[model samples]
Target chain A: MSDVVIAGVGMHPWGKWGRNFVEYGVAAARAALADAGIAWRDVQLVSGADTMRNGYPGYVSGATFAQALGWTGARVASSYAACASGATALEVARAEILAGRCEVALVVGADTTPKGFLAPNAGDRPDDPDWLRFRLLGATNPTYFALYARRRMALYGATETDFAMVRAKNGRHGLENPNARYRKAFSVDEVLASAMVADPLRLLEICATSDGGAAVVLTSAEWAAKRGTEKPVAVRAISTVTPAFPQTVIEMPNFSTDSGVAVPDAVTPFKSAIAAAAYEEAGIGPEDLSLAEVYDLSSALELDWYEDIGLCKAGEAEQLLHDGDTAIGGRIPVNPSGGLACFGEAVPAQALAQVCEVAWQLRGQAGARQVEGAAVGITANQGLFGHGSAVLLSV
Target chain B: MADGATRERVPAVEGWFSIGDAPALIGNRCTSCGTVFFPKASNFCRNPDCNGEVFADAELSRTGTVWSYTDAQYQPPPPYIPRGDPYQPFAIAAVELEAEQMVVLGQVADGFGIADLHVGSRVELVVETLYSDDERDYLVYRWKPLS
Candidate 1:
């Protein structure tokens, strides 16, 4: 596919909007449209990350935002990939633009999460795996992140200090991001002193459920030239890939993992597997990446991404961090926008927000927290329950 | 079921499990490419390559090692918990059973908090009752250190 340029990007500073999701979505969409220098009627397609709307059809969300944006008669679609929802929406929009389906496509993701621990939908139904996991087993979300954190500490000699440093590093950058939810820098002591939610994980180490929104506008490279004649930041590839077969070791919101009983499971662990797919499609390897925006749901998970995304050798992420490689102004800086740790979990909007950060850094437009001379960048996130997404962008 | 409140041990849906300690968990295996799915898939196979009837009954390992473990700090809302008040925390873990060469996640015993777990720790699986309310009951499985 030809390159799709992200002509315009926008966000309604991620914090509790306490408003309907569609409204935040519309506001972000209009902001993106304005940034693209395009009128509302100029866009031809729209896509959105699906939200859990009570009394909705299939949980689809695109048309809702379309209607809120005044029903411009744009071809619309909705996508859901757990935490990776925003990137999935971006993928669909990029596909349409590259396939010659539409020149200007708007991608938006927004959500206002309900208070309390995220649980599965209602119904006595054992038939639905999401509900069954929660119904049969009271496995909450943080427990999953804690599981991975524990695995890393064991396999990689990762220390609580390593995890704390992640928070410290990201918190420092987050303090600079006006769009970030948590702007105050955190101390290693603060992280350790926080209440323990899951073993080895304190409340400070985990991301909170948040209400926020982000949006971006995509158009063909040809369209980009026609509009402004300068080199626009192009979306080189989008990878909304899924997990390999026999998904063993229960994921979040599940009682247990796939039994791996039917056959030999695909060997690559889930996150790295997704990165491999993205790299293959984008025609670049880890060495090619100037920086990355990874799904940092937890501090340990960020280090895990260093391996999964090939930022470093397996089990070497902690040392890489210690070497000051991933920190801003260091080699291959990561999560310069502070990630979910600083931004808070906005569900669907989180991934798209990552893409926005990449676009800014690639164009050398990011103000205080720019990755110096960053060019080629990638954003990797996996939405739980079989929805995977990744994107590679270049200037 | 000892509690007067936990939901009945009614399987939310049918065909997810067979009755026994050696209870071979059943799931849909793709007939075309021989791919196995857990939590059972009666629908299509998720294999990136082959397209075929994804149906099969597969047995999972009954025992495994602790890949990792954590505990709930806040109370989980229903359908995870039937009743809500004075949120009591619980332990959860991911177990790596050598036989299946995969990891399984579940709750650890009620009191096993984060301070009590480490990676590569040995654990065993056991079917345990979750909530037992008046009309129906709920039964789930958990993993604890083999010690």
Candidate 2:
């Protein structure tokens, strides 16, 4: 497979901006186009990540963004995979470039989220599992995160302090990130003192929903070379895999796990399989990663990713945290862009933002958070239902 | 009989759980593969290996061990009606049934909180009133710790 060069990337800073989602997308798209030194009319394709909250326009995000930027007869496609929407859009653009169908493709994702826990569309539908979870058990998203955190404490002897440390580390890492919404550096005590939203996960440890946008300009290596683009960061692999059934882990928006009685459990659990496919395709191991930008929806989930992405053994993630191996200056920094911990979650825009951060780090443009001499980076994120996404990039 | 005292009781989600003293979750077992699904898979078996289109109602084991547990500290958004005014938070648990080898999530029985539950603790399914309307009392399954 030919490499797709990340010619440029841009973001509309994550926050409760309360503006039209299209505005964020347009701003980010224009910035990315300007950064790439390419005109919007010159682009051959526009791939957009869809958001369900914004009515018809969000559903047709590809056309919405294309129209917002003024139509240039670019072919458009939109993808929705909940939080993994951005990566899904990126995959769509990359596929077009690799297939020789389009030399230049632009990927964008933006969202304007509502306040409080993201609930299912107002309804009395009993068949929708997402609604059933909220109606029957009042299981908010934080409920699931707390369940995982409590289980980690029980299974691996991880403590609340260990989880709080993750928040503190990311807080410091994101302090210098201009695009981050919450740039305040938090102490472990401050995190522990915050209101408990769910047992074992305090208010500060959980990510909030925000309004933001992210976009990337991708071109074939030949196209980049033709433009004399020097030292372009290349996307080596993109993985959007689904869980093999009998999925034992209780994922979001689901009431029960698949029964493992009839079929033997899948060899690699859903989260582990996400990055494994990326590494296999990129022909690189976790040891080859200079940095990573994982979906830290909760502080504890970040620790979970350390093990899932093959950075350490299953039960050894806590020790990795204790040894400062995952901090910005550590052996392999994870979430050097402060992750969702700092950015909150802009849902559709998040996964692309992860790639944007990785691209910046690879290009040695990550400012103070830069991993010195950073070369290879990977991003891992999972969305509601069974959407699994990971992208691998190298200079 | 028309007063609130004698309101008719109905399952919040019909066919999901049984009524009466002994409550067991109603799940569908794939006849071909013996895979059980809660909320019942009627159209097709979810087992990727099995192409079985037939299903039988399976009464899941009433008792199971707690896989994990947590409590909601705040009231969730709409579609979830608060059981009482001022919003009393409730404990929730994911129980692992040995027979099904699958985890099912439900609210901890009323009056039970996180302190009463632990991983590997035994629990049994019970029917409880989730909320009541003017016409009927909606019933749902909950997990009660087995002393």
Candidate 3:
């Protein structure tokens, strides 16, 4: 495949803006265009990550963003892969550019969440697994987080204090990130003292839903070369994988696991398989990573991602944190952009926001949060409803 | 001989569990390969190695150890109907069936709290009324401490 490069990236700071998603998307799109020094009309394709939470317009995000950008008559595509929406959107733009179908593509994902735990869209569709989970088990998103948090504590000896450490580290970084929603630094005491959202996971250990937007401009490396764009970070690989059969772990939207009797049972866990696919595609192991941005929907999940991403051996993530290996200046910094703890999930926007952070760090543009001499970076996120996506970028 | 007519006990989700004294979860087992599934997979076995397309109805283990548990302090949004009035928090548990070698999620039986359970505590499945309306009592499976 030909090299596809990110020309620019932009985001509307994550928070409860109470504004329409269209406004957030448009603002980010404009910022990306300006950063790339390219005109909106110059784009040949517009790809958007659809947000299902907000009504009708959110469903047709491509047309919504295209019309907002003055209808340049660009080829538009909208993708929805739950939380992986943004990374999947990036995949769409990359495919178009690599196919030589478009010289320039703009990808955007944005959302404005209402206050409180996210619920299934108002409906009585028992056929939908998401609705079924809530109606049947009352398994809210945090409920699943609690399950994993408790499991990690039981299996790995991870303490509530270890979970608190992750929050403190991410919260400290969030203060340096201008676009972070929660800029206040969190201490271990504060995190532990916060009322328990679920047993084993305090309120501060879990991520909240909030409004945000992220956008990226993609073009062929040749196009960037012609435009004199210097040191552009290029997409080396994008892995969007599904669970292998006999998926052992209990993921969202499933009440029970596939029985192990039929097959020999997978030696590889599902989440590890997600990152492994990316490494294989990029032809680089975890050792090559200068930094990584992983989905930290909850603090415990971040440690799971550490092992899943091969940052350490299985069940060794807590020790990695205690050793400060994942800190900003540590061996391989993870979530330098503050992750979901600092930037509450915008679902559609969060994955690409991860990429925007990687891009900025790779280009040495990330100010106080910059990883010294950062080069190769990767971002991983798992979306509900069977979407596992990871993207590898290098300058 | 009657207390103001009669109300039917309904399965909240049909075909998931048994209705009698030897109550067990109803699941499907691949006859050829012996792979078992809960919530009864009406389709093919999920195992990639299994070519077995035929499934037989099987009764899952009635007792299992608690794999993990949590409490919903906040009222879960709708489709999950609350009993009434001031919302009460409820404990939920994930139990690992030894025979099936899989974990199943269910609400804790009425009157059980997080304090009553531990990671390896043995529990048995029982059908209980989840919520009731004027005409019917909606029944679903709950995990109770093995007495």
Candidates' lDDT values, in order? 0.78, 0.93, 0.89
Candidate 3 retains true contacts at a fraction of 0.63
Cα deviation of B53, candidate 2, in Å:
0.8
Which of the numbered candidates is closest to the native, going by highest lDDT?
2
Give the per-residue lDDT of model 3 (tens digit) for B1-147.
Answer: 168477899998888899988788999898888988987765676676667788899999999998888889888888888877698788888888877878888888889978888788999999988888988989989899885
Stretch of 10 with least lDDT, candidate 1 chain A? A52-61
Candidate 1 per-residue C-alpha lDDT over A1-395 given as tens digits, one digit per residue, 9 for 90 to 100:
45689988888788866778777777788888887788889889989888874337326678888877888788999987778888888888888877889999999988887765677776677666677666665666777788888778887789888999998899988888888989989898988888887777888888887777789999898888888924478787788777776676467666556545456667887777788888888788889888999989888889989988998888999999999899898999989999889988888888999998898888887899999889899988877787677888888
| Candidate 3 chain B, run of 10 with poorest lDDT | B41-50
lDDT for A53 in candidate 1 is: 46
Better-scoring candidate (DockQ), 2 or 3:
2
Candidate 3, residue A340: Cα displacement in angstroms equals 0.3
TM-score, chain A only, candidate 2, equals 0.99
User: Which tens-of-lDDT digit does each residue in A134-207 have in candidate 3?
Assistant: 88777888988888888888888999999999999999888899889999898899999999877888888889
- Candidate 3 Cα errors over 4 Å, as ranges: B5-7, B31-33, B43-45, B48-54
Q: Encode model 1's per-residue lDDT on B1-147: one tens digit a residue.
A: 466554446643466555555544455456777655556656666655556654666766666777777777766667776443567777877777665556766777654655666677776656555665668655556665666
Candidate 2 lDDT over residue span A243-284, tens digit each? 999999888888899999899999999999999999999889
- Alpha-carbon TM-score of each model against the true structure: 0.89, 0.99, 0.96
